[model samples]
Target: MEYILGAVGLLLGAVIMYFVGAGQRKKILEGQSQQDQSYKLEAEKVVSDAKLNAEKIIAEAKLTAEKTFSEFKDKQEEFKQEKIRESREKFQRFKDEFKQEKEDELVELKAKREALKEEQAAMKEERASFKADRDEILKLQEAVKIQEQQLEQRNKKLTEEIERARQKQEELEHQHERFTSELEKIASLSQEEARVRLMEDVRGKTENEAMALKREILEAAKEDAAKDARKVVINTIQRMCSEMTIENTVSVFPLDNDNVKGQIIGREGRNIRAIEAATGAELVVDDTPETIVISSFDPIRREIARLSLKRLVTDGRIHPARVEEVVAKTKKELTQQIMEIGKKTVVELDIHNLPSDLVRYVGRMRFRSSYGQNLLKHSIETAHLCATMAAEMGMNKNQIKLAKRAGLLHDIGKVAEEDSELSHALYGMALCEKLGENPIVVNAVGAHHDEIEMNNLISCIVQACDAISGARPGARREILDGYINRIKELEEIAKKNQGVSSAFAMQAGRELRVIVEADKVSDQHADELSFKISQEIQETMQYPGQIKVMVIRETRAVAYAR
Candidate 1:
């Protein structure tokens, strides 16, 4: 029974074990079946996804093919349109060319017809001309016959005249010999003596007439020269205007009160001395109320001192230190002022492109004076004169510019440093040449004063302008006494002549007019007197430019017509 129970238990246990194993195997098989079903479902999903992708790709390819087909159609249409345009253009060209060829053919036919008509007309004209020439030849034959008859008549007259001329010549020779013999007997003089007397008589009568003729010729020449000179001078003067009064080397500083003079003088005169040292000008603090005189040979120095004094007075500072500081500052300012003045003057004159250094020298001319005339003003006046003259002469623009430039720079040498050995003209010339001025301009600058030879009309214009400016009345501001004395001397020189009733020095002693006694001095003698007086003046007097001597001998017959 234990065996059977154990066996039964064992079998039951085995059967239960088998059943648990079968349950486990079934669970495993169910898990495998679940896995297989999952795999199959995944495969189906994959296959469905691939089919969808394939359809999408096919749709995209078909869309691309449709787009390509549309593009090809558009390209084909464009090409057809291009071909159609090309064919139309070719046909139009051919039609135009065919029309032009037909027109050309018609023109050629017309030209051939016109040429045939012209040839026929020319042939008819030739035939008419030949007939006219034949008639002219027959008329010429008749004229030849008449000419032969005229020659025969002229030959007869010529022979008779020749014979008469031969007889007349013989008679004249015989009469000449008889007259010579008769003259020798009556005169009782040799042929040479007779000739001398005859010549002397002719000379005596001719000399006076010759003298008058010479005077007339000289007057005519002088009139021509005077006319030209007057035109140039009048034109120049009309164009250029400058200050009547010229620059001077002395400056008068007006003080606000007398107390200011003392400040300028300083303690122990140290202030005045310091100012002098700084400005190179002489300070004259005279008793003249509200006035301090600044004096210097150099106009620039005097100007600086005047300006510095004015500045110091304006600032109400008066001391040696202040004076010096003010002077230094004033100098710099004045220097720049000078440069500006120069630049302005050039601009006003319409001159340009000068070297900077040359311009500075030109600025220095503002402070420079020549014979009491301000050099800078003189230069500007000269430039105006030159430009006017150049215009009147019809010079081109470049020549006109050169004329003005040369005239303005002509006196630039006067402002050269004190130690320069050359005269102003020569110095200015050298400066211009070194500064690369035009050769013609350089020549004019140096030759204005005759220090060098003139090479152009510009130089002559500059000289004339300078003379006109300097020689004009009231141009030279000199001592009153000296001017009066010189005028008196000039009159005395003119009065020394025997024919003079009265003498006057006109045009600021530049010209002398003499009134002679009509009875005592004849017109011929008047000429002689003028020549003598001019010669005496030249030999005895030292004067600027030339002196004009005029002798007037008027015969006045007074009659009362009341």
Candidate 2:
């Protein structure tokens, strides 16, 4: 019975196990079936999506094709239009070429017709010329026949004249032989000796007559040449108007106030000392109101000092350093100013082609003086005088220009910076030669002072003009100090004589008057004194004109009634 119950329980347990397994398997199968259905549904959806995508792709391809076709049509139309335009252009060019060819043919035909007409006219002229030439030939043949007849007549006349001339020549020879023998016997000499004596007499007479004629001619020429020379000089002087003033070494610097003098002097005169050392000039502050005198032998120095002082006074900065700076700057400016003055002078004088260095020297002449005359003014006057004289002497334009140029540059050496031992004339000549001046101009510059021999007419003109300019009245003046000293010396010279009691200088030192004591000097002695005094004046002193020495010795009975 336990076994039966155990078996039943096992079967029940087994049945229950089997049922549970079946249920699990049934659930798995259902789950598998659901997955299969889901897969099928997903597949169907994929296929539908693919069809839709295919339709969309077809639609896009159609659109692309239609667009391509439309573009092809557009391109085709453009190509056709281009081809048509090209064909039309070709046709027009062909028509134009044909027309041009026709026009050229017509022009050629017209030219041919004109040429034919000209040829016909030339042919007619040639026919007329041939006829005229034939007539001329006939006339020439007739003239040749007439000439042949005249030549035959001349030949006959010439034969008869030859016979007569031969007989005459024979007779003349016989006569000459007889005359020679008779001349020898009458003169008691050989034929050759007699001929020589006659020749000598004729030669002596001719020589004497020629010398007298030559002397007369020379005398006449001297008178005429003197008259012409005076006329030329007088004309040149009349044409010129020049300044008459003395150029002094001292330049007056005008100031706005007297107070500016103190500033220029500076503290302890350091400013002035600096100015002097820098410019090589002296600043003289004297009692003269509103004027400072800048004194220097070099006008350039005085000008620099003046300008430097002007700048210092204007800027109100007066010190040693500032003074030097201003003076240096002023010197540069003055140098540049000198160059400008030179250029202006050359331009105004119409002088050309001068070197820059030489031009600078010309400007320096403005600050130079010769015998109390401004060198530049003197040069200008001399230039004008030279030009005028050259013109008067019948010189051409080129020679006149040369004369003027030479005159202007004649005194260039006086302003030279070098301290040369040579005279200004020679130095000027060397400078001109060094600078490539014309030979004539160089000679004129050297010979103006008569230091060198003149080589040409222009050189003589320059010298003459220079003298005329300098020797003109009121053209130059003696310095006041010099004049006073000269006057005192003139009086002293007369007083130093033994017979003279008192002496006086008269006529601007042109004459000297000596009064002698009557008791000490007789009339004869007075005459001797005068001669001795005149000799002494001539020997000891250099003067412009003759100085008249008059010695007075008169007896005076003088009683003063009081």
Candidate 3:
């Protein structure tokens, strides 16, 4: 029984140990299973996340493709719109060009049609004129035939009248011879001697009467002609003497400061000497208060010097080299100024198509002055006067232009000393001739000063223009002393004349009035005294305009007041 109990305890111990060990193994197995489950769950979770990520990536690719397709479509639409706009713009440009071309074509066609119409109209007028001429010739022929018939009838009547006159004359001669023979027998003296004395006495009386009638007719005609001539002269003078003022050439330049005068006369006078040499001018630095005079015989040189000096003073740079440079520049400027003045003159005068050289010559006259009169101004005035007279005379406009041009150029030789070898008139003529001026102009220029004989109307006009310019009142002046001496000489000449009680010189010495005793001078003697005074005045005086000599004959009978 003890052995059996021990065996049972051992068996129980082995069983308890086995069960505890098994339980421990089971817990370990369970932990292993839980770990495997957790790993499986984690593996499943990773596969699910991978599937989700792949789906997301595919979805994102699809969306990207759709977006790309949409963008491409938009791009295509935009490109199409741009192409359409380009086409429209191109179409508009083409349409405008076409419209303009059509308009131009239409205008050309219209002009051509108008020209054709004008041609047709001119042709019709010409045809009508030819027809009129034919009709006029026929009318003239008919009139001529009628005139011829009338002339034949008149000639027949003249022959019949002449025959009758011849028959009557023959009968008269026979009767006269018979009467003469009867008278001779009755008379105491011979017929031939009696007739001679009677004829001689009648001839002497008739001759005296005829001589008186001849003298009276001649005197009346002379008086009428003299009166008409005087009227014409007065009328011409009055018409030509318009108000004219002579213009002088005087240029003035202003200075900046007095100190500039020293700079102008630079270190040791080098600047002034250079300027003088370059411009050929005399610089007069006087006490005129900020002014200097540039004096030169050549007006152009003086103008250049004046301008150069002004520029130097203003720039405040004075040296020999600078002076030379400024002078050259001033010369160029003056040349341009001269040319501009010339061009302006031509334009003002309405003179076109002048030769280039001729225009230059005309400009040179700006620097020339004659007796205080600006040459250019005088030329312009002469041109205007000539043109006015020509218009009044109804002359050809081109001919008038030639005359005016010749008048303006009459003193052109004075501008060029080298060309002044000939007289002014001759040189002017040669210049015109070289320039191929109108023959009338060439001839007029040569003959203006009577260097050549006056051969054309233009020449006479030039001479008249010169006289008008020089002889008008205030047009010219002589020295005051010279004028006084001339007046004194005239007074002395008149005082020396005999039978003159008082003598008065008037009309600027153009007329002399002599008062003589009435008892000493008869009507015939007065005429003789006037003639003598006129002859003496002509021989002694050298003056323009004709001098009039009047011998006054006055016989006053005074009554005494009681």
lDDT of each: 0.77, 0.78, 0.71
Ranking by lDDT: 2, 1, 3
Best by lDDT: 2
lDDT, residue 412, model 3: 73
Listed in order, each prediction's TM-score against the native is 0.47, 0.43, 0.44
lDDT of 1 by residue, 66-182 (tens): 777788899999999999999999999999999999999999999967976886798699899988876765565555455546544554544455455546555654654565566
For model 2 the local lDDT of residue 530 reads 82
Give a tens-digit lDDT track for model 2, residues 397-442.
Answer: 9999999999998988898787899999999999999999999999
Best by TM-score: 1
lDDT of 3 by residue, 1-562 (tens): 3333444455556556656755765688687755555755665565566556555555666666677778889999999999999999999999999999999999999996797688679869989998986676566555545544554454354445445544544554455455456657777657786556554654454434444444454465457556555655554444333321112323455677677778777776667778988988868676777777676667788789888988888788889888899999999988888788889888988887777677777888988877656788778878877777776778898878877887777777778646346887888788888988888888887887888987778778877786666544444455556656666776667667677788777766667888888887665566667766776776786765787878889999999999
- Lowest summed lDDT window (length 10), candidate 3: 241-250
Sorted on TM-score, best first, the list reads 1, 3, 2
1 or 3, greater by TM-score: 1
Q: Candidate 1, 139: how far from true, in Å?
A: 99
